[model samples]
Target: MIIAFWVSLFIILYTFIGYGFVLFLLIKIKRLFYTPASFDANLEFPSVTILVAAYNEEDIVDAKVENTLRLDYPQEKKQIIFVTDGSTDSTTEKLNRFNDVLVLHEDSRAGKMAAIKRAMPFVEGEILIFTDANTFLNDEAIKELVKHYRNHKVGAVAGEKRIFVDQTADASSAGEGFYWKYESLLKKWDYELYSNVGAAGELFSIRTRLYENVESDTIIDDHMIAMRIAEKRYIIAYEPKAYAMETASANTAEELKRKIRIAAGGIQSIFRLKKLQIPLIIRYLHFNTSVIVC
Candidate 1:
């Protein structure tokens, strides 16, 4: 009876207080995210390289290219590179027509990390932004992300990832939407309180100097790369204005598979980066909550 009572009490304490701690941090963060800065539109835009990983993304490749070319930043200041791995379809074929975009195609599908590794040598920029072929960024995303580099202390910047809600919605869509909404809220606060624990590849930037090639089989390479930089004490800022839009994962079961894969990878990531997972030491409630969803 005593043990059972203690267990119930413990669950209650964690459910209420633990969640409250996250909320408290988020409240403090909202003030930070909204704080204005002296960022200038006329400021010199440094050269940037945007890397997109495409694996069988033929249907969306054209849209991705068109959107990247339309980024509000000056063309002379940035480059877009599409890395296609094991794209046994029209993805490579579609990329061939774009002279402005550099396309790297490999026959073997070694996964996203491998494609990124092959493309890293070709990147000629002070900063590199990693994005997915499935997501589309705001026109001002590059401009908004680059302005924070004026501080120099900021090593990486994450953007808001919005899931476009449509009329033919389903539970998977709702689940995915709810996940990112909760995620975006947490990210807004996480960066405000301190640095965001990691950056989502949907839209995130990092200094070229800090760029390190992760393992070929890396399940959550984005988190590993971003957090590795964070462990070095560099600030990973979050900008809500710089957003990326994408649809739900076709359906909930697909989203579930994605979530499960992420959760499994997250378990590996935590063990590898365990030194940084000390509760309250590093902002991980949102991250752990994400893991639980899978």
Candidate 2:
């Protein structure tokens, strides 16, 4: 019983804190021996398609469009596509007003993965970027994400997600904000060490040609999409400079629900992404057990 208690205590501490320390130390040692490759400054930017999936988000559809338009990418090389599969609101109407943006909508209420699948055929860019309809991206987001594509091994690039919490924020909001801040740090180390386990939906990009169609019922489409590419032995690079900003959940209850959903998705993804799971023996042999999920 004493040995079991000690083992359980170690697991809990390692899950919450010890792993971060180990990761930091591993990264420090790695940096001493490894140097990142440099890219040519004269290389031209590749054509990019910024895909946004919106469902009944009329309030922020226009703002999202404006934000996308404001991104610092070559106008001629960038394509903006918004997919509203089941939006009954003015989301489709508002998006229609943007002559520079392409709007795809269907009355049937298919899930987000379904909407993305429908938008796949229309993607005309060498690089495909995915962002949430409600989050606002920094102007350099597209530029930062696409730059990593110059490295042939980088199959996907994940941008940071920032939560905005003002002074009046409740415990949930502040906690959420702090959580992401730590997550951002872990993702940085994860990329530097090898590759991130998964990418968040707030903002992430992949090579158009490498895109694989996931199941329509995918619970965490973004995570699945990125991990599938990772399973191909390609790197999913993380860029802290290119971030998506959004408000925290409305309340503690909502925050809890969001976390629970994510936890469930993580379990689902682990079973589906069998290739990413290293056997206990292998991990023990390598002394590497830290897995960073974004």
Candidate 3:
């Protein structure tokens, strides 16, 4: 009994301290190297397609389109697509105001991944960016994401997601804020040490050729997108400066729903991507920290 008790205590201690130590070592190693987020002049810049899936996002659809259209790239080199599958609101109407945006809408309430699948064939850009309608990207997001492709080995890039907290919000907001900060750190180091395990749902970009159609019922399309690319022996990098910003979930319950779905997706991804697990040491290590920290 004593041996078992001591073992359990040791395991708990090791989990708490050991995870921090591993993250610290990784951060140290990352600071040990330097990387530049720019491409050589000789490398031809590729076209990009920004794809957004919206559901009842009328409140922010206009802002989303404005932010997307303002991305730094040649207008001719960018294709904007907004897909609204389940929205009964003005989301489709607001998106239609922009002639450059190709809006795809269906009255049927298919899931988010289904919406993205419908937009796939319409994407003409060499690169495809999947973003949430509620989140807005920085002006240089496209440029930063594309620069990673300068290295042929990089198949996907996940941008940092920032949650703007309202001080009046409750403890869940604080928790969510803290969680993403830790996540941002993990992704930064993962990309530095090897490749990011998963992309933030707010904004992630991938090579069009490398883009694969995820399962129609995918719970977390952004993560599945990155993991799928990682399975192809390609790296999913993190560009912190290229960012997407969104508000915390409407409240704690809504946020919990979001969290539960993500947790479920994480479990599902293990089976969907069993073949890739042996190669993703960073994901294994990073996940250890997350389950503990959360």
TM-score of each: 0.88, 0.92, 0.88
Q: Give one digit per residue, the lDDT tens place, for model 3 in 20-87.
A: 56867877876768654456655667998999888999998888888887887899999999888878
Q: Predict model 1's lDDT versus the native.
A: 0.80
Best by lDDT: 2
lDDT tens digits by residue: candidate 1, 39-62 = 877778889999999999889899
- Give the residue spans of candidate 1 off by over 4 A: 1-38, 279-282
- Please identify model 3 stretches exceeding 4 Å from their true place: 1-17, 26-44, 285-293
Clashing pairs in 1: 172-252
Candidate 3: which pairs clash?
none
Candidate-wise lDDT, in order: 0.80, 0.84, 0.81
Better of 1 and 2 by TM-score: 2
> On lDDT, who's better, 2 or 3?
2
